[model samples]
Target: MRNTQQRKTEWLNIQWKGGVMTHPVQQDGSSCGVIVVLMAREIMKAFPNVPILQFGTSRKEMANERKMMALQILKASVFDEAENCSMCSLKKPTGSVHRFINWIQCDTCERWYHEKCLGMAKEDLEQARANTWSCILCS
Candidate 1:
């Protein structure tokens, strides 16, 4: 028999308001699990009702803290730290010079990450490759 009494925290909305940009809640950004949508799916499997909370802050102090944390994480992003490669930095003109097509190369693998795609950081990706590592998605 399964224990229905044990309640789990499932849904989380992480709203970030930076300068002029705000990214809505996302599961991956919170480091909670795989895709954010999957969190809802998993919760549905175990319980009918799930508790959700919005992370970060409504107050200035908390907001500052949240911003700092975000800065730290972003600083370590592959775009900032990884070595640039040809395939990673090419762009196609869109209007007069090419406005619609911009391409990015993977820091570790040197493959292309298109306008709407994201990839693992080169350092982490390289470490994984060297250690024979595979993530859940890869595995």
Candidate 2:
């Protein structure tokens, strides 16, 4: 047979070199994306050495993966890191706070940080040598 464009495009089933491996069937409707991402992570971590032991994910595990994936999305996010606290560096800090009061700013660089994010506790505020306290980078 002559080499042809049709044959090249048609090579999927007829020309497959290695045996195919099947991913486990999705159990939950919403977990499809999570399962795909989980599979990729598992492959990257274990390929060429260890074999994957399981792929049947439970609904509870999917829920956990959803949170984990959200966190990963935030941490691996493309948004401006400059807006985040230099210490924790998360795009947004959690919980209720009065920004002007609960958040503190460095006297030097002027970067803002959540009170909980600081290494110093509220009690340690009195122990500070001077009224002005610098952020970790500034100090």
Candidate 3:
């Protein structure tokens, strides 16, 4: 199997035109997938006429676009519940120590919690891993 960096590089190689477009540099290691999806959405909105496989624009231009898109996201007033832990209601800041904690989401209630908060042992949690998991209350 490809290693993490190799897999990431392979993902970045997806073409937009003849030129390969670079993925935005994520501010942190966490939430990269979310950032990528958001970046793609912003790019699509900004360049509706541009073909997905065409990267006629410069990298610098795309970087600037990304910055602008980030600003737009920050300016929006809508809040996402996933920004906090469901049980404790603690904000999960990207750079905080909580970022390193193992958090699980309940598929039924769509709520998030630190694994320890749910009285889950690390081994038990690993053994029970599934595509969708429900918390004890939901289960």
Rank by TM-score, highest first: 2, 3, 1
What's model 1's overall lDDT?
0.45
For candidate 3, report its TM-score: 0.34
Summarize candidate 1's per-residue lDDT along 1-139 as a digit string, tens digits: 2333457433333355667445454312343332343456557766866745434333453445556667877887655313322334323322325455434444444444333333556676556555654333334
* Of candidates 2 and 1, the better by TM-score: 2
Question: Residue 112 in candidate 3 has what lDDT?
Answer: 81
Give per-model TM-scores.
Answer: 0.20, 0.37, 0.34
> How large is the C-alpha RMSD of every model relative to the true structure?
22.5, 14.3, 18.6
Cα lDDT tens digits for candidate 2, 20-62: 5554566666687988788788888888766584755888888
Q: In TM-score terms, which candidate is top?
A: 2
RMSD of 3: 18.6
Off by over 4 Å in 3: 1-80, 92-99
CA-lDDT, candidates in order: 0.45, 0.69, 0.63
Sort all candidates by lDDT, best to worst. Answer: 2, 3, 1
Residue 15's lDDT in candidate 3: 58
Q: Which residue pairs does candidate 1 place in steric collision?
A: 88-105, 93-97, 93-98, 93-99, 94-98, 94-99, 94-100, 95-99
